[model samples]
Target: MKPTAPRYDAVIMGGGLAGLTLALQLRQRFDDLSVLVLERRAHPVPHAAHKVGESSVEIGAHYFDTVLGLKPHFENEQLRKFGFRFFFSEGRRDIDGVTEIGASRYLSVPSYQIDRGILENYLAQEAARHGVHFADDAFVRRIELAEDGATHHRLQWTQGGETRDTEARWLIDACGRAGLLKRKLGLAQPNDHDANAVWFRIGECITIDHWSDDEAWRARCDPQARWLSTNHLVGAGYWVWLIPLASGSHSVGIVADQKLHPLATIDTFDKAMAWFATYQPRLYEALDGKRHLLQDFAFLRHFSYGCKQVFSDRRWALTGEAGLFLDPFYSPGSDFIAIGNTYITDLIAHDRRGRSIEARAQLYDQIYHSFYESTLALYQDQYPLFGDPEVLPVKVIWDYAYYWGVLSQIFFQGRLTDLALLGSVRDELQHCQRLNLAVQALLRAWSGASEKRNRAAMLDQAAMPWFAELNRSLNDRLDDAAFKARIRASTAQLRQLAGEILARARDCDPALEAVALEALLAHPEYRGAQRLSAAPQHDGAMLFAVPAG
Candidate 1:
């Protein structure tokens, strides 16, 4: 369908995080551009509290503060600082060190244990301050593009028993997991096998006395601690998160796969608590025997969905989960929303300044997709071992380093234009994949050997070489200022190499592309037999997880 230029610059559907954030970005970037936000709910204020992605790693927090100009309020209301911490359920061991993965005193930044409803209300107010109009309780019936296709979106919505037609030059989909426009356009496709989640908030608090003597830990655990967040991997396909809010309350929830809890049902607070008791006794105990449940448990399946195209010839773009979602293990959900908002605003500004929207949109899509693919690879490699006690140190260190490193460069340094950052991320992801494959290979080789002998042999022969190299690389790079400088230089060079590789792929140089993909998949630090799988098609792309037998 064709689209005609409309009176308003953009119309944002679903006034949640993505919608309101994008609206604010658009208004901030272009003073004269008119933007309208439509929300289905009458008021976005918290009634029954809910927990979405509560832990915002450093980069996510940085984006919120620096890009959105929301740092001040976030610091005041929702921000907290803690060096990253995680627990392995099998042995409940603690691993601590100082590296990218073990940095001490990393800012917890401004992650929220916020009610989505309350957050949306604040976002609406912020958007209003930027001159974006907001309409609540307006459910959109359908969207029709104009005939000319010159940037137009027509929305049919029902509000107060009246059907109204709203038109805009651009339409943004921030409808989250609902994927309203994505499904309507037939652009939505599942990225991975269905993953389900059951999440709700509990009023109980979990105290960590282990760090009682550490000043940082003491502050974080204090009753007055406004932004306390903690997490633990319970077992395969299950994890728990605890987040403290400013209201002198905490939010607790568990996310697990249906396969892990086939009989678990969260119909009531008591049922949810009982399920937690069965699966995560420590967390259940930390909640002080009996805790108040804030809302009914919610399930999310088909969790990772993305559109084939994020933008159209007509005036429409996807943001947040409407565009793409991966596993929430790293709290990328809200980060993507903020990132998309920034990108969309930049595209709009370029268009207003006489640049080509199509070209900008294409570039935007490529960059976003590449980032998503790289991140997904990282998560996929880590998910299987999330609950393994033996690997707790590895997981904690890797996660902390990766999360804080990105946050430091992006937010603290304000270096978003550096493609090197993404390249480094790709490198880390590939390394992780290699480690996982090597571990699997060693396990299979030792199937008939005694557990102690096999474990000792594998540790000494198969894992140590790569583990040493990784440890050395991490320590060398993170231990000194010179190492950080070297990393930045190396990353720049790598990004240039990646660009060339991308060009080769496009030019149909299959052999060269294959070589590059192999290089990405091969980690010299890993010394073990290779697992059988298709050669990588893209440098940072994740192969789908093999289902458990």
Candidate 2:
């Protein structure tokens, strides 16, 4: 950036995924506006063993592929993920004999196993190519946010033993967990989801499909490409993720409840190996054979957290890890990046047009926080149910249904910035959020009451036409009217499904107590609860397929 070129329109701190993506979005949205991104790390970051969060679900995938127009890079560089796969085998060595909960075939909506280093490098390069200055190896020594009514916030960074200063009207903190602004303002808040993570990268891919020799197990999958999936080896209060990267390395992680599997147990690499031996021995033996291929290992204690605020009226904002991060179980890191970046882009554009932005910023902050809280419900106080194959399968279906049905549709349809539309569907959206909280509570109660159904069978999601169609519908193209209608319909679908799930839980355990769901079902307006709910989706596939009398 030219020192004498006057102030930048926006200065983004910490050129990680969020910072670089914000820079790109700002540059793309306002071509003539000047944007500068500062990063402490040097570029061309080491590939393969770079960073965690390699998996991407629908929301994040749509952001990178469609919104950012990086579809070519996805096709050429990244590995197309085979959807989120989960195995309920806890202690047993044989994965084939366990209950698997994922699609037998690939879902129509595509996501990717992102190589973080590669993706960030591309973002930085793309930003620079588009005239947005991305400065690496620049340490932000001090951040002096603007005072009340101040036009610009001042920032100082050091590079090559020289300190430099600049000012910008808009400042965005995307410094990952560093939380430069979040700490400076004491915006950090305690999260209820106290989970820890220990992750490492292997030099080469670890194939799960080869773990068993049973011909029947081998023949279960059509293509027998389980290795391509973001395979989760799940247990009681923990789950191990095995993600294959296009960089020829596989990313492996163990995320567990702090109460169930403490951080001390898997803090170090050797401890991680030891934990694997106890919890996942088959994987342990595989890694032990090629221990020399271990590339990098790291751990995070209570990995999830929140910020008191992300966007501010003082012309500042925090994105990605600088903001609130719920959990990585569903790989939601990049998806938030997409949403935050989009909101920031709109805010900047609105300001440039001399529009009043304080109210909008406050509203956006509230909406984003709501999204965080709702997503957090999925993991908070719900880890104990992770190992319960019966409850977990239902939870997975409900979680994905909510994701694809509501959030994904809103994002995929680009209705995020449409404040009017969000307002219009306020009741429906609130109902969806309320329904999610209720469903999560009901699932926990059902898990506590129900007997452990240890059936050694795989419940293939793809085999379920309704589940497969829910995954496929994420790729649908809809006009403005159709998009709004689709979201409303999806909300209704979730409500109906939630009712059905509650009824089935009650049926299984007649004495089960689901206060929220029970109250809703008892309401005179709810007629379906008296009967079995079999809500058909757009594909006319029955979502709430209860047993026939």
Candidate 3:
């Protein structure tokens, strides 16, 4: 007779960040729940260079710190991010002589620059401590998802050179690009945002502070910790990322639009160095001396993708990169992970309580995909405008407002599954989405028609009061009435910002038409708010001193 398979309430596949976190969340929410995490790689993975998602934004950070109760780990083991910093340096050696866009000081809310290896290792340990069954060095042999909701999903795997079988009420795929369930269910889809990326980790720090000799330029940022930020060296059609890890290493990568910078040009270390020499001479010079310190090199073509389905009534789901991935421009990888994991956990809870999750599954799927689509607007065709210092600065402001004002508001208020509140504020959320789409189109148009200013100046995000406050306001605890009112106000803020952006673009080129934005603002609902200016002035003064121009 065949041996009986062990059964669990939840069996999460590929116990990396997403899987491990889901296990912990489930165990945390329901102490009696039995959960197992099967990861392919062994535990205690090498630090600094093990993986690429080394940066966390507001949503991801909050999910890890607050939702999962791992704040202490982040505080002690990871690096607190100095916020995102950018330099429009292309074919330029003078790092301080380019258009800079970033905060002059850290914002009120916190994010972290995570070393994936360290975080994952720590997550594994934490999951075990929290009573989660974690199986490292496990290779999944096959998955047999139940066709009916009443039956358990069966998963087959190998560990210690022996095959094992288990049945689970909830089977989650957090396997990263492997898409174990996604591929089996024929759910893979393609997105039109064709881009490529090549990333590697350096064993030593690629400190930007030493790049410039100007004391004043160095003094622009408080604490003089530019090296602590996720710095982007941007140019036409491409941007290079510099993310610091806690384990005394730096992560670097080049993301480019395939149309302009072909993957072949910088697919290898030598090729990347040569390509960087021409477009990013300063960064190239920084890396040229650290060739021996290269910890890992990897590249992916057409990295952005979509999924036909992630949540299902059949009691199986896909989380993290297994579902879909947009660009890494804003480090949204972990944000999506937080979102998917939350939905999965909720679905499991509903099933455990004998509640019908069929309709809720479909609704949550739609909402999650809507979030993905809204964020995709920020990166889809926006790469072409990255080099336009003026337009990009304004675009960054709009993007952050849309983020902090809408989605981040909902998440921070602990309302991810608040279907009632979300339904009540449906109109506002949809309007916010429309405004973002229009603003993105307007930004692209503005970039095309403007002079594409690359002059040396700092567009200080911290100096903008509304921008800083919007970020700080994420920590506010709100009741239902307050949350609804906040959503309405946030919608109005987006409209006001849209109007200001449209006006600014028209100031540059009066002929530029922003029909969608104009039409949205013309709506009776948006008629009366005082237009709030969220961007800094064009003059290069006040926030920080520019080189004695």
Candidate 4:
């Protein structure tokens, strides 16, 4: 007689960030919940050269630290990011002579530079300790779904040369781009932002602060900590990123718009170096100095993509790279994973309680899709603006404001699964979403003709009171009503700022077309009297200063 297979509450495919985190979440929420994580890769993935999502932002950080109760691990095992730093030094070598946008000190909110191998290994261990069945080196051959909603999903995989079978009430695809479920369902959707990336890891730190021996320049920052940030070397159609790892290695990548910077231009290590030699000469010189320390190199063409559906009432879902992926410009990979996993967890919780999950799942799916669409608009047609000194800073400020003001507040407030709360703020949230879409369009239009003065001054975000205050607010613990009021005020502030931005765009050139955005902010109270401005003419004048030689 054949042996009987084990049945589990959840079987998550692809034991990367999404799968492992989900397993941990399920086990944490419900004690003794039978969960299985199937990972094709064996245990102990390589350290620094493992995977690409080495950078984490606010939401992902909160998920890993607060929600998952892994704060100690983050502080001890990983490097705290010093916030994002950008240098508009395209085709230039002198780092001092460029418009810089970054903080002089660490931001109040904490993020991290993760070594995927180390983090995943720790996560797997945590899963096992929590009683999750984490099967490494598992080669999944078949995923057969039940046609009737009452039956459980079944799958078969090989582990250590022995075939194993299992049945799961809920099946999740966290398989990255392999998209086992998505491919079978034909849900893969092509997006407009076609970008390519080439990345490698070096067994060393590439500190930007050390590049210039000018003591005056180094002293501009409070602690002179440039290497601790995710630094971007910007150009017209591409940007090179330098992310440091806790393992004493540095992750470098060249992400470019396919139409502007062809994949063949930077397809291989040699070609990438040459391409950097022309577009980002400073990075080339830095890499040239440490060529012998190069550990690994890889590339992917047209990386940005979309999916038709992710969450469903059928007890199956897609999270992370298994469903959709947008551009990696702002390091949103892990952020989206945090978001998607939350929805899946909520739906599973609803199902386990014998509550009706169809309505909740559909609503969650809509909310998740809306988030994807809004974020996608930011990078879809904005690559050319990546190097614009004047426009890019304003864009960055606007983007950061919206992120912290709205989405970050929701996550920080622990409202991801609060359908009732979301329903109550339906009108406000919808208006905010509309404002975001309009602002993205307005920024793209503004960036088209905005002049790049290429002023060589360091714009210290720390000096700007409002900007710094926003960063500080991330740590504030607010009550329900207070959080709602906070979000409302933030949206109002953003609306005024968008109007001022449009005014400046008109000031630069009278012919720009932004009728819709203008209409949204066409009230008389937004007139000549006084509204906040980040420019030098306003109280924000002291934000940027030139370093003495």
Q: Per model, how many backbone clashes are there?
A: 8, 1, 1, 0
Write model 4 residue lDDT over 316-391, tens digit each, in one string.
9999999999887889988899999999998998888889888888888888988898788778888988888878
Model 1: lDDT equals 0.54
- What's model 4's overall lDDT? 0.85
lDDT of 2 by residue, 431-540 (tens): 78888898999999999987666566766777777677667777777776776677667766776678778867887798888888766545454334222122225444
Question: Which tens-of-lDDT digit does each residue in 1-549 have in candidate 1?
Answer: 223323578888888878887887777777899998888877756632644765665556656666678876676766364433444433222211111111223332334444455566788888888898888888889887656644566778778887777787778888776777888888876666345565665544445443224454333333423225444444555666666555445566565555554424643567767766666555556554545545445666546665687865455788887788887666777767766777777777766787677765776677677567656654543444445433433334333334333333343444343445545555543443343333333222222121211010101111223222222232221323433343343333233333333332333333232333345434354323232121111233111111222
> TM-scores across all candidates?
0.71, 0.95, 0.96, 0.95
Q: How many clashing residue pairs are found in candidate 3?
A: 1
Per-residue lDDT tens digits for candidate 3, residues 1-549, read 123789898898988888888899899999999999999998789998788888999999999999998999999999999999999998899988888989889999999999999999999998999999999999989887777434788878999999898988888899999999988989999999999999999899989989999998999999899999999999879999999999999999999999989999999989999998999999988998899999999999999999999999888999999999999999998899999989998998998889999999999999999999999999999999999877888888888889998999999998999999999999889989999999999999999998876777777888877778788889888898888888887887777778788878888899998888888888886678542333221322112222234
lDDT of 4 at 25: 88
Alpha-carbon lDDT, every model: 0.54, 0.84, 0.89, 0.85
Off by over 4 Å in 3: 1-3, 148-150, 529-549
Best by lDDT: 3
Off by over 4 Å in 2: 1-6, 522-549
